[model samples]
Target: MSTPTSTDLVVGARPDHLISPHGVLDLRGSAGRDVWLSYPFDAAVVVCGLPGSGKSTLLRAWAASATVVDPRVTRTSFEARMPAWLPYASYRPWARLRHMHWLRGELRRGGPLLIHDCGSRSWMRGWLARTARRAGRPLHMVVLDVGAPEALSGQQARRRLASRRVFALHRRGLARFLRQVERGGQAQVPGISSVVVFDRGQRDRITAVRFGSRPS
Candidate 1:
């Protein structure tokens, strides 16, 4: 991992209004309690991580009421209708397509959106960037940075481990993205306005993600 730079340093206790001028904020090693993040009213927030990283958990904790587009939610809905014996792999493609359709509809709504993504797809980030730019909204990313062992533990806890090959692929992708972020090239993702990085230990410290509201 890249050593923390000056820009990555933690801010004051009240950091609800902090936005890095360089468009990236690293909070992986920050020590704070009840940390809050606030963004614009129409910001497109993308929560990214490995397959087993606690992306879904973080989203539920932070943006429970927002318009969230989560693939897992879509898949669960499909699973609810399918026979118990049927495997999710059997209809993964259809579920993915449905999720994309739902994402498109949510994007067009032009309000605050919290998206759960596996950080492996650059194309999806590009699409989100374009959509945000079109609507004059900011595109922000929240990355859950965890080691393979930690991620695997998370998967085991959730009882949904990804295949070895798939986990390796996602690891590579997330590594590449983090490298770019370290090199200050995250802006190359087109319209990414800001990025907040958090390690596993720092996850629970984030109390909430507030949008278009002043901290109380």
Candidate 2:
């Protein structure tokens, strides 16, 4: 929704790499064009992290070749132009409302959807999974493993700090979710075809997001 800031940009990004190979789905009468379709991913891809865990940076890198649905982009844009007197809390609801509306529209249109999540709220995780499933698209999760101190430092660098309480809530939820993932708890999140884990270093190495590149 908003332009990616110079600092909040990924250096490199790439297409989603398939972990489990399978037959392609939903081809509209193409005789021998399999190579041209379903090369990247057929489901929604979500990148999750805490407030300052670099989700926006990654999205910016991916934006060039992918559809990245991020709420912070809009939020930041609004804050940039708003009067200093108006607290973000006053308009926070509207920002969230706009994000939800945009997300719905994007999903409806549907094709290689990419999302940025903060690993909070079980309801949202389930909802996204369900939506992708209903649309016959696989949902993949890219979780960033960042420590609290590091994330907080990132916030300081950005000149924005998330409320302690809110950040704590997100951290707790993320911890539990990550635990499940480590234990091979696939059932924890339904409709997830694969989970790609990334750390700060790995994320920094990304530069682009392509949608039709199959892995060899």
Candidate 3:
């Protein structure tokens, strides 16, 4: 594995700022406070982070209030029908294809959506950006930032550690993406209009993720 730089491992706390189609908002250093994020009714909110970076945890919370498209949920449903002893690795390709299909359907429907993804694939992000743009809906991203150690600990806690090679690839991809966002170059991400960053501690402070014109 490649050694990670400080910036690649941790994102410093920064105040919110928007440069038209690009915005950087950091949810950190807030104590005893709740954070609420609001967007238009048809916005597509993509939740991204490294493996075991609490992406699943946050998505679970939003599931009740939002239309969430989670790959894990698709995987779980697949597991429900298959034999219990069968490993997920065996049917991973099918599950991924199914997840993508679900995502495409959701994008086509064009309502408020909170999508869970690794944010490591430029092609996937590009496709999403293009689809949202064509539909005349804004695409937003919520990134969960955490160090490798903390992410690994989370994996251990969840008993679902990614393979070292896969994890390294995700780290490299996420690092490159974060570098661009932190540099105020989110416009470089094509149709991604905003990026909201949160460290593990700050992520827990989120009270609700409200969408549309209503107060959050």
Question: Once superposed on the true structure, which residue ranges of model 2 sit more than 4 Å away at CA?
Answer: 1-41, 76-84, 213-216
lDDT string for model 3 (142-177, tens) is: 888886888999999999989999999999998888
Once fitted onto the true fold, the runs of candidate 1 whose alpha carbons sit more than 4 angstroms away are 1-22, 83-87, 213-216
Q: For each predicted model, how many residue pairs clash, with residues at least 3 apart or on different chains?
A: 0, 8, 0
Error of 3 at 169 (Å): 1.1
- What are the per-residue Cα lDDT tens digits for candidate 2 across 73-147? 779877998898999999998888888778877777766778988967788888887777777667766677667
Question: What number of backbone clashes does candidate 2 have, counting pairs of residues 3 or more apart or in separate chains?
Answer: 8
Ranking by TM-score: 1, 3, 2
Clashing pairs in 1: none
TM-score of each: 0.83, 0.72, 0.81
The CA lDDT of each predicted structure is 0.76, 0.64, 0.76
Q: For candidate 1, lDDT tens digit of each residue in 41-152?
A: 7777899999778998888886664788888889999999999999999999999889988877787777789999987777777887887777667788888897788899
